[model samples]
Target: MIDLHGFGNQLLQGAVITVELAFASLIVGLILGLLGASAKLSSIKALQWIANAYTTIIRGIPELLTVLIIYFGATSVLMSVASLFGYEEYIEIGPFVAGVTALGLTFGAYATEVFRGALQSIPKGQHEAAVALGMGNVRKFYRIILPQVWRMALPGLGNLFLVLLKDTALVSVVGLDDIMRKASIAVSSTKEPFLFYSAAACMYLILTIISMVAVHYMEKKASRGIKRT
Candidate 1:
C-alpha cells in the first residue's frame, strides 16, 4: 500500500467533489437531451433547426474550450449585466457552476443524438396501438413509449456518463479542486509527482468501476420482462 503521506483525506474529499460534479452535470445533460430530442422530433422546422445547431456547434468544439468559454464568458457577461445595473464590482463564476454548465452542455449534445435514435427505434405500431386504446398523446408517451426508450437509451447514456466522469478532470483547470487538482497540490507540496498522480488515477479507476457496475444493474432492471432473442 503506497502511503498517501497525510493527503489521503484531501484526495478523498476531492473524489467526493468529482462525484458531485459528475452527478450535477448528468442531471443538466439529461434535461437538455430530452428537450433536444423532443425539438428534433417535433414538426416545427424552427425547433429542429435550433436543436441541430446546438448539437452541431457543441459537438464540434473541444470540451476544454467549452469549459474555458463558460467559465470566463459567464463572468464577463455577468459583469457587463451588473454594470448596466450600476453594480461595478467584478463578477465571478464558481468553478463548480461553470464546470457543470460546460460539461453538461457537451454531454447533452451527444446524448441528444442517442435519445433521438432511441426515440426513433420504437415500433410505430406500438404508438398506433396506444392511440387505438384511447390513450392521449402524453399518456401514451409516458405509459408506453418512455419505458422502451429508457431501455434503449440506457447503454448509450451509460457510455456518455463514463466519458463525463473522466471529463470532470477538466474542471481542475478552472481550479475546482477535483481529484486531479488535489493531486496536483499534493505533488507540489510533497514533491512526489508519481505517488500523488498514481493515487488520483486509482481513485478515478475506482469511480469508473463503481459507475460501470451501477449502469449494468440499471440496464438489467430496465430490460426486465423483455423477451430476448
Candidate 2:
C-alpha cells in the first residue's frame, strides 16, 4: 500500500524522463536528418556515401542492440579519451545521456528516410523557379523548401517520434531507471506483477495520448492554409 504510492511517483518521474529523452533525441536527430537527406539528394559522392551508410547501418540493426552497443561502447571510448588526458577516475555515461544518444542515433536514421521522401515530393519546378529568380541554394531552402518539407514530413516524423518515445522503456536494460524499471521494482516488492505492469501500461498510454494530441495540433499548424483531403 505505502509502496504503491511511492511506486506511482517513481513511474511518473520515469515517464517524464522518457519524454525528455524523446524530445532531446528528436531535436538532435532532426539536424542529422536534414543533413543526411540533403546529402542523399545532393550530387556529392562522398557526402552521399556517408549519409547512406548512416541510414543503412542503423536501420539494419535492432534498436535494442543499438542502445546496448552505444551505451557500453560510448563509455569505453570516453574513458579512453579521459585516460589519455591523465584524469581517469572513471568516465560514466548516465542513463539519461545514454538513452538520448541511442534514441537520437536511431531516430536520425529513420528521420533521414522521412525527410528524403518529403524532399523528393516537391515539384522540380519549385527549385527551378527559385534558381531562375536568382535565389541562392541556402536562401531558397530556408525560404521555400524548408517550409514545405517540414509540412510534408511532419506526419512521418510524428510517427517515428512516437515509436522513439515508447522504446525509451527499453533503456532500462542499460540500467536506466525508466518507468518500466521502476515498475519492475514495485512488482518485485509487492509480488503483484500484473498490477504494477498494468499501471505502467497506463502510464505509457497516457504518454501516447498526450503525443497524439500534440501531433494533431502540430499537423494542423503546419498545414495551415494548405488544403488536405
Candidate 3:
C-alpha cells in the first residue's frame, strides 16, 4: 500500500534517520547513566544529591516538554553567551542535536536507576574476594564487577532502549525528518491521513520487533553460566 503511493522511498529514508537518532541518543544516555549511577552510589553526599536531583527532575517532566524546553532553552542560552563574546549571529542547534540531547537526558534518568539497582545487586563478598586475590581496583572492576553488572543490567537497559527508540518519533515535532514527520508530509500532500499514519505505525512496529528479537538473543547469551531458577 505504501509503495503504491511512492511513499516507500521517503519512509525508508525517514526510518534511517530514526535509527540514527535512536543510536546517538543511546550512546549519550549510556554514558550519562553510568556516571549518574556511580555518583548515586558513591560515598560523597554532594555527588549523591546531584545525581538524585538529575533523575528526579528529568523523570518528573514529560518527554515532549523536555524536548521543547531543551531545544528552545539551549538555543536561547547559546545565543546569549555568544552575544557576550561579540558573535551575535543567530546560532542554533540542529534538530538532531536537540532531539538527541532531550531524548538522551530522559533515557539517562531512568537508566540511572536501573544501573544503580544492578550495581547494588552484586554481593559485597565478590569485591572482598577480588581484593583477597590481590587484584587491583581497576582489574577487580573490569574482571569481576563489570561482567556481572552487564549480565544483570542488560534486560532493564534493553527495555529502556526500546522506549528510547519509540521516543525518537517525538523529534519529529522539532523538524527532524523522522518517520512521523515524513508521514505527516505525505498525509498533507495526498490528503490520506489513515494510509500514511498506518504506514508509519507499521514501520515503527517492525523496528520494535527487530529490537526485541536482538535483545532476547543478547539476554540468552548473557545468561550463560547462571543457574536457571
User: Could you say which candidate leads in lDDT?
Assistant: 1
Regions of model 3 farther than 4 Å from truth? 1-4, 79-92
For model 1, residues 1-229, the per-residue Cα lDDT tens digits are 3458989989999999999999999999999998999999999999999999999999999899999999989888888889999999976679999999999999999999999999999999999999999999899989998999999999999999999999999999999999999999999999999998889999999999999999999999999999887
- Weakest 10 consecutive residues of candidate 2 by summed lDDT: 1-10
Alpha carbon deviation, residue 92, candidate 2 (Å):
3.7
Candidate 2 residues lying further than 4 Å off, grouped into runs, are: 1-5, 79-91
Given candidate 1, what's the lDDT at residue 18?
100
- CA RMSD of each candidate after superposition: 2.2, 2.5, 2.0
Per-residue lDDT of 1-229 in model 2, one digit per residue for the tens? 2357468788877777777888998898899889889999899999999999999999999989988888889988988888899978887788778888888888999999999999999999999999999999899999999999999999999999889888888898888888899888888888999988888888888888899899999999999999778
lDDT of each: 0.95, 0.88, 0.93
Q: Write the per-residue lDDT of candidate 3 for residues 1-229, one digit (tens) a residue.
A: 3583888889899999999999999999998998999999999999999999999999998999999998889989988999999998997698999999999999999999999999999999999999999999999989998889889999999999999999999989989999999999999889999988999999999999999999999998988999999
Ranking by lDDT: 1, 3, 2
- TM-scores for every predicted model: 0.93, 0.91, 0.93
